[model samples]
Target: MRLRPHHLLCTQGYSGKGYSEAFVKNMDAVVHRLRTEDKTPIELVFSTDDLCSCCPDMLDTDLCRENEKVKLFDRKTAEYFGLEEKTYIYQKLASYIRRHITPDMLADICHGCSWYPASACREKITGIK
Candidate 1:
């Protein structure tokens, strides 16, 4: 079924209430509680800007970059895995390369986990030039 528009809480009676944080918090707690309830299983899926959550550092995105298993975890969380070789982020980077972001030298663009900072594509995002 389509999942995008489902409200975390039903707001049918209330129009004056603007963005219910209380309802959101209660809903979040309910979701966490129900997940381990054993009688019912609730599966929530979202993208990894994901692997970022598991990691303490967003500047160093290595946990997602280095281990394919963590990558697979995010995949499994989002959906059933194995639909592609490259990730959505990787593909977006590749697309950037094809367009405006020309690398000045070979070393500037890294192919694999190079053990630098968590900043995966630092130069691209920072506007260093």
Candidate 2:
């Protein structure tokens, strides 16, 4: 899975009503698969990949309607983690997430997201009430 930087955060299990059912299903499957497999191949890239490929809002084949919004998520994650484009193990990435990302940071990054208010991801990552 070649994922954009922002997807590193979004794939932690957030779902919004605006997404297509197919997008939701594919994302769920991808996240589950990555979590269960110890060495699933994941590369950090600037362009879209597995997750955005299924998005209903995709335009011109690969661009997302929410591309700017997604970019913010990516930027914040990269800034906090000192990320670079590289191949990584999914399990290792998950560990980095648990170790490096903080609740306040996730909250600020996701605040502008349309799904922010109802996101299970927000609750899980931040325990925010």
Candidate 3:
């Protein structure tokens, strides 16, 4: 499964509450698969991914209705983690997130996201051990 840079953070616990039920379900399934399937190599993608595939906002095969905003988030996340699109294991991304992305940066990175207010990602990121 491929994932956007920000999704490495988003999937830690963010609930797709405001999005479609199918989108939320797909996100949950992806997260579960990432957490359990050791064989699944989750590539770090700069564009649309498995999670975005289920979103209603996806415009084309690899585009989003809010493409500009999405790109901004993706760039910010990639820059923060010093990552480029490449094949990566889920554990490696999670480890980078825990070792580098601090609480203060979390606030800035997530401030533009609508889900940040109610999403469990804040607690999940802080509680990473």
Best by TM-score: 3
Error of 1 at 62 (Å): 11
Candidate 2 per-residue lDDT over residues 19-126, each given as its tens digit: 888997888788778767878878998667888888877774446787787777777777877888899776787677766667788887776886766667765554
Tell me the TM-score of model 1: 0.19
Report, for every candidate in turn, its global Cα lDDT versus the true structure: 0.30, 0.74, 0.80
Ranking by TM-score: 3, 2, 1
Per-residue lDDT for 9-115 in model 3, tens only?
88876654638989988877887777777656778888899888889999887689988877888888888888888888887678778777787788777767887
Q: Which candidate, 1 or 3, has the higher TM-score? A: 3
Tell me the deviation in Å of residue 62 in model 3: 3.3
Residue-level lDDT of model 1, residues 1-129, one tens digit each, is: 001001111111112222245544543444444333444322222332321332333234334333454444334322322233332333232333334433332123233323214332334432332
Clashes within 3 Å, all models in order: 4, 0, 0
Task: Return the lDDT, model 1, position 82.
Answer: 27
lDDT score for residue 58 of model 2: 74
Off by over 4 Å in 1: 1-31, 36-46, 49-54, 57-67, 75-129
List pairs with backbone clashes in candidate 2: none
